[model samples]
Target: MSDTAIRVTGRCRCEKNPVRFEYTKVPAEVHYCLCTDCTDISGGAMALIAVVERSTFRITQGESKIHNYDTKPTCHRRFCSECGCHMFLYVDAFPEHLLIHVPTLDRGQDIGAKPDRYVFVNSKLAWLTLPDDGLPRHQGWANSGAPVEV
Candidate 1:
């Protein structure tokens, strides 16, 4: 089935003024990001990102509670101002897409896509170990770089 036939919903961490969002199309790509910027801001060793087309994604609620933090000149990360949860972001390099944090999806909702690879593995934390899932590991962005030996 076409990914556009599926829909998924998500919300931010705020109890009273949650920032809600939904995407009707399947993501163009999904992967694990180990870039320091993503890992540092999210306080995790890695980040699961769903690259959804901007035209198919929308904020459904709490628009007034949304805030933008420019993690870099080319990256604008959006979060819920009330609860400070970073749920999505826009990258200048991928103007047509919005990168959604996978964990923001409502529990049990089919994410509509599976992570195909791990990117920025060269920046991965030393204490963390990659899983044996067999996904390709890239030293940088998946599109511009070659897979690295795991």
Candidate 2:
């Protein structure tokens, strides 16, 4: 599909004044994040994230209903005020991009990309076993320059 024609829509859990968002291009990167902050806040084993350019993303609705919480000094997570569903986050380390929770996207439509690797494996819970997906597993951030043994 043409770059400008490609669009993906997603929303928070709220039925009213839900936080709606859309992106016009394929994400730059997609990965499974095993960071403690992501897993703890999401209440999940890991977070599937799609890194998209800020210029291609837009909040279509519930702008006022979106609440931001600084998970840390560098990470500002935005969620729906009503449902408290975390939708996206801005990281100081990637100023030009936004990290979106993959599950927030409407099902049945292509997410425009596939997760290529796993990040923060160093912080992965010991009880959680990773799938034998053959994706590169990074010990830290994907670009952290740390060696991947598996």
Candidate 3:
């Protein structure tokens, strides 16, 4: 990671009108999530999320235009109301982290880490074949050799 803060922002699909936000500093890691909650809420086979410290994220613009929904009792997802772009989410499992959808980052910005792993493989869509990449695939969260299970 570089000493300079890594910043990113993005708009909804309608490039004409957009809701934007920006964040700084390096993210912990990026991961591909295939959990049902992710797929259902994002309306996609998988969702790519950059996990950054919550305190480092902020809505620089369109604060009033963003809306949220609790996909589950413990998961609060935020999106642009107009274009309906899923932006970020706060998960109870990791309260200190903000899960920013990779698609929401400005096109030219450096999004920090490449995906280090694929998560929730057990729930991946039946028709979707994961790439033959070498990244670790975890049924749940990666163990990271942590003594305490998350």
Instruction: Please tell me which predicted candidate would have the highest lDDT against the true structure.
Output: 1
| lDDT of each candidate versus the true structure | 0.92, 0.90, 0.81
Candidate 1 clash pair list: none
Q: Tens-digit lDDT track for model 3 on 1-150?
A: 568577777566656557777778788889999899999988899999999988888877767878899989999998888888888999988989999899878787677668888888878778998887777788876653322211
Question: Quick one: ranking by lDDT, best first?
Answer: 1, 2, 3
TM-score of each: 0.96, 0.94, 0.87
What's the ranking of the predictions by TM-score, best on top? 1, 2, 3
Off by over 4 Å in 1: 1-3
**Local accuracy of candidate 2 as per-residue lDDT tens digits, 90-150:** 9998999999999998888888899999998998888999998888888878888654754
The prediction achieving the highest TM-score against the true structure is 1
- What lDDT is obtained when candidate 3 is compared to the true structure? 0.81
lDDT digits (tens) for residues 1-150 of candidate 1: 663668899999988868999999989999999999999999999999999999999999999999999999999999888888999999999999999999999989788899999998999888899999989999989976778886
Worst 10 residues of 3 by lDDT: 141-150
- Per-residue lDDT, model 2, residue 108, is 88
RMSD (CA, Å), each prediction: 1.3, 1.5, 3.6
